[model samples]
Target: MFEQGDWGSAADWAVAPVDHSRLKHPVQALTAMVLVARQENAAAAQKVFTAVCAYRMGIAEDFDRLGEQAADWLGVGAEMEVALVLGVSVGTARKLISVGVTLDTRLPLVKAAFVAGELDFSRVRTIVDAVDGVSEATVSAVEAAIVDAALQRPPRALANEIARLLIAANPDDAAESRKKREKHSRTVKITPDSHGMAALFATMTAAEGVVVSTRIDEMAATVCRRDPRTPATLRTDAFVALINCETHLACRCETADCPFAHLPAAEPATVHLHVHVDVETLLGFADNPANLEGHGPIDPDLARRFAQDATWQAIVEETRSRCPAKAHPAGFVPTATKLLPPPVPSGIGGAIADIKAAIDADPKVLDGEFPDGHGGLDEPPPGALSYRPRKEVKDKVYAKYSTCTFPNCYVPVRKCQFDHIEPFDHSDPERGGWTIESNGHPACPYHHQAKTDGIFRVVRMAGDAIVWVSRNGAVGITIPEELGGSHEPEARKPVKLTRPAPAEDPPDDAIYDPTWWEQHMQSGDRPPTLADMAQLTDRRLAVIYRELGTHYEEHLAILAARDRHMPPPY
Candidate 1:
């Protein structure tokens, strides 16, 4: 029975009243907030769906009056209007309209549940999508079967349940639909991300994906344990190596004793990865960022590494003004100088010329196209090594510890050195301390040195946890990884750490304190108005807007019905 104005102020609609002091745990507070937020979000979405339905109904009236010719134009205009208001793409708006219509027309129960906050948007979208091409008779049954589970399950689980029920309802149609999707929907796409990285997305049959993943894992595992790359990173490198037709990942340990170190480098792939860098940065004179093809700007250091094996090409920028010449009476040369390719361009001047050539090429080259055959674009340079640990010992240590053993340190175990807890008897092997799994712990170089220099002390404790005592007497504890147990003797009377008390909750005024907003405005920023705040709170203004749209749609329908009944003027 809420009226248009009953929703109150934008702040009232947006902020939920949660007594944080009443919640015993942070998790309880968070859970309460999430539930309230979901309810508000659902309410907002229901308003949007209501508005969209009404808008489309009014448009339908125009379509009927103006005939079928105006359908496309009206539809495009409608999508654009929604897109502008939502600040989303036309395609997204179209999808939203379609989902809204589906929810309004077919799945009334789902819509009710959605507005009541029992089902989230993703679950509703999943149900709507699953029933898209389904026969009307079967879809209702599918909706009824899954709506209860959809309330409790995640979107993915809900999708699976929906799929299972769909197949059960009509197995033949489901099989045919899946077959059509597999034939037409398989695609490989690369999307650019921030920080000079790109995500490669591929939609293929599950079997094909499994095959690719297994092959990558196999190739990644071929490297010795001393390789510094994490399993995930190694897998990625292995996938790239497979694309380049290489057998295995090159061990990055870089030690002369490494099994893969002495192996000859694999021949470069025909596909070249182009990098655009400035002349100064290429020559190591500057540290400016360089753009990798497809990917965005990468560190200059990474660019230099790419340059080591890259083929050189020079492209000099030309000026409109002609150079001076002794042959001409005008004392200038009309033709520009044609510079030849430098020999041994791997050196300083040659490297600079190479970079200039790369920069001058078509910007489309960034899309990973280079007709010229060049190799080693994807291969990373070998890292310098200090010491090497036994492969078995390193493997055991890595399996036991996923990250560095130093307190509060999260450096991946692959990137850490296996340090001997009790200094190894290098001079005499049988003199007690040995390079065994019981005595080894992974530590990053910095902390490894500190431990070796007595700046920090770590001792094995009861329950396979390591106690770290710092120089300042601040103590920290590290529990062993889940995969393995330690055989080392435990220390006596280990200190028991106490959990710190939670901080006092902030005063209610802090939620929408005007002091911070005033300060922001004082700093020459544009202060947001109520309308803007309402939009920021996910269309809280829709409370009033939905009411207006409903009345507008009703008026349009009445006009349409009256006009249809009226005699045409001849």
Candidate 2:
């Protein structure tokens, strides 16, 4: 060691800074490799997989380009893989194809326009029904955007891009738009007819603050006059709304004689349950005038006659009793107990077994039509609740936790579950129940367990971003660049509470239009629009002849050809 200078002349060596730029591509490639290796990151792989498979399938250049850009190449590859492995049926093929196409692009938004109600695609749809939407050109443009985004980023990023495209191009039907705009404004008031109408009148406060002193029969007549073919579902639903608005049954007496006597003054006043009715049988009553016991088919003109009766009001105002209501005993069903038949015959496993059997047989025969999973739906699965609450719940979980809540794990929502920051069971019912609102936090199960097992604790700071304090008392706030907005779980970014920045002069290129490259290559060459993406996919599949044997032979031949062409590495 003392003779180092004499032995090595100070060990002169030039340690040049390694050029990391050359390694960037390989790093990205390796990152992608790791991503595709996992089943959860299949969405990213799907884009590339679909594109490559489409090229193999002899798809058109235009569409192959689309597939490549959208990275639907991986998806198509998976489909072929499934078909080859599982011997997928024609119906299954159709379904998978539809889903693949929809998920590969922003097409669901277009198809959603023609359907009534919320933009939910869970209902059944005919193939013909699926095609109903805006013009093809618009949809193609949207898909193009999705494909562009897919090529640039990962699956979640692609979805965000698709969402942005949808917002920019509102593809909703004109009629649907008008209806949506008019929905809250179109108000109607009607009084439901029941024995003892006075009691119902007294409960008017319980109604939706919507009360009309007129009979439902009269209201139905008025609605009929507006639209000749009033559907029964609509009529019944409207009646339910009317009842929700104007009917309340209360008992002043706290004695055992009254059914509601056990409840204190602060207790819930009304217990609402679904009233079931058989439509066909009810309609049968409408067929015969003589079938109406003393009264004709609910004459609208007779509302005045009934409204003047004091006996009806007295009965309506009376207290609840053990005796159920006298209305349509045979036809009416308790609302809650009617629609879904009180869970399955047994537990979840039984229901699942039944579903499996249905799948083996005809699924239609089992669960009726599929309640959700419409032909070309693309929206993410809603979590926990069927309906999202009106106000934004700060601690509410996302449909999925898109990113790793653990400071280290950046796994996305597709592989995530809600994490209760404070263990849910910690809240005693004796004190208060744990609700999904404040107690729930979206996290991958692994990270959630880590948080729960006294390793870490998650807290939402002022900016709504999650901050974690480790058991060792190390404080680390996840920066946005390290992950994405999944940790925040808000629909939009919260307004910055910091003081506004001073206005700066706009750059000369601030409002610059698209360049020639953008106009021709970048923007124009985006994948098909959301509306046209599915149809185009179907059309491509229809023409691409599924020559399984030919494909297999071709694949083998290609492997052989590659063997002949390539030199073996030592």
Q: Residues 177-259, candidate 1, lDDT per residue (tens digit)?
A: 77877888789976556766778899898799999999988989878999998888998999899988898776888788887
CA lDDT of each prediction against the hidden true structure: 0.57, 0.35
What TM-score would candidate 1 get against the native?
A: 0.46
True-vs-predicted CA distance for residue 50, candidate 2, Å: 13
TM-score for all predictions?
Answer: 0.46, 0.18
Residue by residue across 28-146, what tens digits does model 2's lDDT show? Answer: 76865443343333332343335335434523432444545534332333232333223443234345455435433435443333122211122212221222343455456565454
Residue 227, model 1: Cα distance from true site in angstroms = 3.3
